[model samples]
Target: MATANGKLLTVPEVLAELGGEVARSTFYEWRAKNQAPKCIKLPNGEIRVRRSEFDRWLESRTEEAA
Candidate 1:
């Protein structure tokens, strides 16, 4: 489903869409450690990570790795 601004992505989807090979469980682990991107928890208990936020996170990681 598209968000208010036409974004349609989940955490794993965002990671894959960005060409990140992170595993689903690993992503959850990162989230547990507060090391993942910013996110929103909906009333249905679903986690949603914004595409823009993930992009920024990926860019930051790339810069850090450089």
Candidate 2:
């Protein structure tokens, strides 16, 4: 399900949003490690992340580096 802000993003979309700085395998690794952004598993078994959550997660990472 998409948030009011925008549509839910796929793994590839999330990668593009991050400018492809991280490889797909690495992203999946992070997800497995619970270090990635929040995601939702649809009934169809598809994974998606809300744009707002992704943005928030990115901001948190930036703050962590500060």
Task: Highest lDDT: give the candidate number.
Answer: 2
Instruction: Give the C-alpha miss distance for residue 20 in model 2, angstroms.
Output: 1.5
Cα distance off (Å), candidate 1, residue 34: 1.2
- Give the TM-scores of the predictions, in the order they appear: 0.73, 0.81
List the lowest-lDDT window of 10 residues for candidate 1: 57-66
**In candidate 1, what are the lDDT values of residues 4-56, reduced to their tens digit?**
75465786686677578777888789889988888788899778887777777
- Per-residue lDDT of 17-63 in model 2, one digit per residue for the tens? 88989899998899999999998888999889988889889988874
Model 1 CA deviation exceeding 4 Å by range: 4-8, 18-20, 64-66
Q: What is the TM-score (0 to 1) of candidate 1? A: 0.73
- TM-score (C-alpha) between model 2 and the true structure: 0.81
lDDT at 30 for candidate 2?
Answer: 96
Q: In model 2, which runs have C-alpha deviations exceeding 4 angstroms?
A: 63-66
